[model samples]
Target: MSQQTSILILDDEPIVSKRLRPSLEKKGYEVETFTSSVDALARVRERKFNIVVTDLKMEGVDGMQFLTEVKSLYPDTEVIVITGFATMATAKESFSKGVFDFLAKPFKLGEITEVIAKAEEKINNS
Candidate 1:
């Protein structure tokens, strides 16, 4: 059997990470969650994650910057950007920066699950 996919979730809100962890874990992903971007970045440097789901707006190291950093450090890591402040420009920029998916806030768990499935497929194929 193949190894479990590793995922890192970064958001300023504790509830975001809290809500996503169990759901992704249940889907068989090896999940790590962080409320602080700094802490998350530190972890990212330590290990390669197959996927990263991160909030766009945060106190330190906003999602766009974090995405750039992750891509630079780990080009193969698939990134999904989730944002409360979703805009066409931001979404465009995310795509330009190699984001795998962009999800708006208040999304259903099923939506994320679908996206995760897609990411998993890509990882497996790669």
Candidate 2:
């Protein structure tokens, strides 16, 4: 049997994790959601995930730092940045820092799924 794709989701809002976990799981991913970036980073240290979906603004250890750390530690792990406070600068920064995709907040589920699909393809190909 094929192994399930493992996904880590980090967002300060509980509702975002609540909503995304099941949807991603339905698509055959092993999804773990976190409202705390610090805790999520701890988990990331414990094991590598195939993908990480994170919000840019958080109380501690914001997305940019998290993205930088993750890319440095696990270059193969694909990261997708989601932020309500989307700016061209932030988007450009995310891309430059090596995020697989950047998503603006209040996004549709379909949009996220599509991005995940692309990330999955990359994971499989590599």
Candidate 3:
């Protein structure tokens, strides 16, 4: 496996990607940010990513739909769902759908780094 990993960050809020992009890039990840799931889905079809990090709620396409689509098209790409509204139902559903991870909002840089690192490791191993 290559040391260089590609990660897709999908969120309607620019700040989520803004804050995450630099941090992940600094960790040596090739990161792409999409403000819309529609655009992100197009990109996903074009290129293969090691992991996809997405917000659970968005204006047009919700995270669950995005998650389902990504899984259907790219089964190898791991997904991490992040949301401010963390509920038991969401957690159970995401896991049942084989989501890579679930992160609530207000996550620190360190926490995200750890999760990404873990996911990357899993992908590399697989």
The TM-score ranking, best first, is 2, 1, 3
TM-score for candidate 3, residues paired by index: 0.95
| TM agreement with the true structure for every prediction | 0.97, 0.98, 0.95
Q: Give all candidates' CA lDDT scores.
A: 0.93, 0.94, 0.91
Deviation from native of the Cα of residue 59 in model 3, angstroms? 0.8
Tens-place lDDT digits, model 1, residues 1-126: 989999999999898888889998997999999999999999998999999999999998898999999999999899999999999999999999999999999999899889988988998898
> Residue 101, candidate 1: how far off, in angstroms?
0.6
Q: What is the lDDT of residue 14 in candidate 3?
A: 95
What's the lDDT for candidate 2? 0.94
Of 1 and 2, which scores higher on lDDT? 2
Residues 52-114, candidate 2: write the lDDT tens digits: 999999999999999898898899999999999999999999999999999998999999999
Query: After superposing candidate 3, which stretches have Cα over 4 Å from the reference?
Result: 1-3
Give model 1's TM-score versus the native structure.
0.97
